[model samples]
Target: MKILYLSLRFPYPPFSGDKIRTYNILKHLSYKHSISFVSFMLSPDEKNQINKLQEFCKEVEIVEFSKLKAYSNCIIRSYSGEPFQISYWYSPEMQKKVDNLMEKDGFDLVHVQFFRMAQYIKKYTDRRKILDSGDSFWLNLSRRSKLDRGIVWPLLKLEASKVRIYETEIAKWFDQVTMVSPLDMQCLLSNDSNLPISVVPMGVDLDYFQPGSKSDDLNLLFTGTIRYFPNKDAILYFYNEIFPLIKESVPNVKFYVVGNSPPKNIQNLASNGDIVVTGRVEDVRPYFDNSAVFVCPLRSGSGMQAKILEAMAMGVPVVTTSMGVTAFDAFIDKDIMVADDPKLFANKVIQLLKDRELRQNIALNARHLVEEKYGWSSIVDRFDKIYENALANRS
Candidate 1:
């Protein structure tokens, strides 16, 4: 099969949410399908990985996007009645390339990675179009608005409102659309009952994140790209509302905030010995191994938590909210322990720290869960079926 894969960002290094999903899917699907990638890149550093991607992709086109230009576009089109994301990524050059590709290549499918890129491909009816919206952007923005500041809050709400209308409107045009979690699929269905939506979840590299020897340090861990709204909110909520309660019970308890590009506020958290923020580490497996419990107290997010899956895959006991585990079909207290309340979340962590047997059981079950249901090969096979179904329904 031949696929024209459209990405908002060039998927390399696969560190962040959008990049991870796109890169993994390309790697897996490219083995069997001829994938031609068209995307944008911000930094020259990102181009280093083009060679790696070109190994699988038949052709790779990287559009140069600048921070200044993106912001300029954002302000210029804020009144265009479309979401800011859509405006920022709109490029006539890239659109011409896509239009030419469809005319010349005669690809089997047009696979777009996000709604931001949807504006470019939504009108392309010449091929079987599959929109892979990894998560519910509107739902996510709505949650972010709840915790946003005065002026920014209203802007976020406006964006969310626009996305709700935009996503539902565009859903009718695509042959099929995909989300990473069932909750997100529900969000899309709520918009349009008849829209075809499928759940193709984020997968973990099982062999890379295998079980390690548990450490004696009473360290609690949470890992994600620290600058992201979902992750930033989660760590702040944990530090301010939850960690103090745990500290009262277990005085020596330490929390490790692991991942990349933490802001000053997040970095300031490291001033106190209780919270240790590693801005950007090459690997996070050590944090998982040393942790007595992994906590994901995300206040607002619409899809699966990759950090939760990665820790669980590394055989780390996880304690997270109802929102945290919503994506996975994992059983509560069976595969992992769950609590929404700050006090309750702390108690779960303390309990796990004290009860080594229960901790190990959760870790073991979590590892088993991902191994069976969340590997890349298994997920790509599912995508294969969805592609076939989309083509079959194509008019």
Candidate 2:
């Protein structure tokens, strides 16, 4: 198949969930398909990595987007009936590029990565599109608003309303759409009943994240891009609400917060002796290897949590919120544990920490689940069928 793929961000580095999913899926799909990818770069450094993506794309085109301009556009459009994310990524140069691409040798499929980038391609009525709005923006925004208070809260409430309408409105443009999980698919349906959507889960590099010997001390680990709002909130929730409860039960429990770009609040977590925030490690497997349990205290976020999947793939026992495990079909007690409240979540983590047998059982079960279902090769195979189905329906 020949695909014209568009993304909000460059798929290099594969650091964030969106990047990881796009990178891995396209990498695998490229083996059998031809792709013409056009995306935005946040920095000049990403320009150097175009060669990496060229391995998967028959042709790769990228434009540098200004962070200052993106934020400005986001705020400016926040008052209107449009998703702030959609406005943030709006660019004339990219629009012109897309116009030229569509006019040239036509693609078999046009796949747009996120709602943020949907504005660029959604208006093109002449071609069929597959939108990967993996993170249901409105649902995510709704959750985020409740977590916040006062001035920002009202703004978030307004944005959520705008996004809900925008998301529902844009659904009709795509020949088909896909999200990261069943839960997100459900969200999309609730907003727009007729929206064509499917779930193609985020996959893990199982071999790279394989299980290794854990450290001697009973420790808790959390891994994610600390720069993100949801992840920062999750870490803070774990530190402020959940950690005290766990410490009361196990006095010497160490919390290892590992990921890229630790914000001030996350960095503050390391001020205490028990918390260790390692900002931007080259490899995260070592932190997984040294932890007894992985906790994802996500107060608000939509779609799949990539960190949870990576931890599960590494054979680490996971205790997460109801939101955290929404992406998986894993059992509550068998494959992983779910707890929404701080006390309840703390108890689940403590149980895994205290009971070696329980931890091992959950870890092995979780690992088996990842190996059986969450491999990139298998995910791309599923997407191939979806692509065929889209083409058939279009004809």
Candidate 3:
């Protein structure tokens, strides 16, 4: 199949969840299908990475999006009904590129990566489009509104409303739409009942993340791009609400907040000794292997937590909130420890820290779950089927 894959960002380096998910799926699909990619490059460095992607994609086209231009567009559209996020990515150059490609070579299917890029293809409803929503953007925005406060709160609330309006209307333009988790799909269906939605889970590389032979001391780790609101909030929640409680019992225990672009608050937490914030490492598997527990205390976010899956695939025991476990179908006691409250979360982490047998059992179960369900090969196969279905329906 001649597939046109449209991405909101360049899926290179595969460091973060969004990029990793898109890159792995495209890598797998490239084996059985020919893919031509058109995506926005955030930096000049990303342009050089396009050569690396050429190994998988038959053709790759990346358009650099200037921060100044995107922000200006957002301000211009903020006055109107459109979501700032959608407007931020709006570029005539991208539309022109897509138009030029479609006019020159006919594609069997067009796979739009995220909601931000959905605007470019909404008018091209005549062609088969498989919209990968990634997550329900409206739902995420609405959740954010409740968490944000004061003046920023009203802005978030307004943006959330705009996102819902856009989502409901733009969804009608795609042949089919998919999200990372069943929970996200349900949220989308509830908001827009008529849209055809499916679940294509985020995948992990099990080989690189498999269980280690030895276990380290009771060290708790939380990994993500700390610049993101949900991740920053999660770490803040851990440091402020949960870690203090855990410290009373496990005085020697260490907490590592590992990721890129950590805020000053997170950096300050690192100064207090027990908490260490390693901003962006070349690899995260070693940290996962060395840690006694992986905790994701996410209060607000949509879709699956890829870090949880990565840790699970590494055979590391995990303790997370109900929000952290969002779209995954794994059993709580069998695969992980699920806790919504800070005290209970701290208790669970402490329990796993002391009980080696329990930790090993949960880690083994979690690894089994990922290998069977969340492995890259299996997840991408589902995407291939969805693409085939979209093309078949179009014909």
Q: Pick the candidate with the highest lDDT.
A: 1
Give the per-residue lDDT digits (tens) of candidate 2, residues 11-124. 789888989988987898899999999999888999999999987789999988988887988777766757676778888888999889988967888888887777888777
Candidate 1: list runs displaced more than 4 Å.
Answer: none
lDDT of 1 by residue, 100-132 (tens): 887889888889888888778877766688888
lDDT of every predicted structure (CA atoms): 0.88, 0.87, 0.87
Best-fitting candidate, scored by TM-score: 3
Of the two candidates 1 and 2, the one with more favorable lDDT, higher being better, is: 1
Residue range with the least summed lDDT across 10 consecutive positions in model 1: 118-127
TM values, all candidates: 0.97, 0.96, 0.98
What are the clashing pairs of model 1?
A: none
| Cα lDDT for residue 318, candidate 2 | 93
